[model samples]
Target: MKYLAAYLLLTAGGKANPTDADIKSLLSSVGVEAEDERVSALVASLKEKNIDEVIAEGKEKLASVPTGGAAAAGGAAAGGAAGAEEAKEEAKEEEKEESDEDMGFGLFD
Candidate 1:
């Protein structure tokens, strides 16, 4: 069931309603087998009119869950900032070493 939901969300791709056959085919391709009755029930429960709606609703629900957009964005920003800071520090160290060498601070000196 969870797999079915994920499949719908994945293939929806910003559409509103995906047909029952489309859902069934996707599930079948992914090795999720079920009787026609069950499949029908599942499709009926989806209540989606098009892929866009499914995607939108799925995104909304996902946003409501933990570790959603804000957390992900914050983590990414923090990671990028940290990486940039490290690179800057390394460059500063390199510049300092170059300056020292230029001033005759080396093994020969």
Candidate 2:
């Protein structure tokens, strides 16, 4: 993930294609040790690919992912129901407390 982040940073900075050494240098600058095997593999895999095209493909793939707005609405409904129940319980408790009071039978009465 770190390697990929560094590669993307370099690519975003107009490197177009960042070498393994470039990735290593960036990681090392942040006191991270780069794994040569992973770096080489990453370099090999992306060597023939255009960064822009890859990002576009990734975006297209991500477009089909569900945001679950319906699930969120259901959660909100559940939360609201819970809140209403709490309010009712509080109102009941208040009523009980009032009934336990003097109930208009004061000293002057």
lDDT of 1 at 42: 63
Please report, in order, the local distance difference test score of every candidate based on alpha carbons: 0.68, 0.89
Question: Please, what are the lDDT tens digits per residue for candidate 2 over residues 37-98?
Answer: 99999999899799889889989999988789878888778899787788899999998876
Candidate 1 RMSD to the correct structure: 9.9
What lDDT does candidate 2 reach at residue 13? 87
In candidate 1, where is summed lDDT lowest over 10 consecutive residues?
Answer: 10-19
Show model 2 residue runs off by greater than 4 Å.
70-109
TM-score of 1: 0.34
- Lowest lDDT sum, 10 consecutive residues, model 2, at 100-109
Runs of candidate 1 exceeding 4 Å displacement: 48-109
Q: Clashing residue pairs, candidate 2? A: none
lDDT of 1 by residue, 3-108 (tens): 4674466555653555566666667787876467765676677664555676699899987788677887877788997877888999999988767656556665
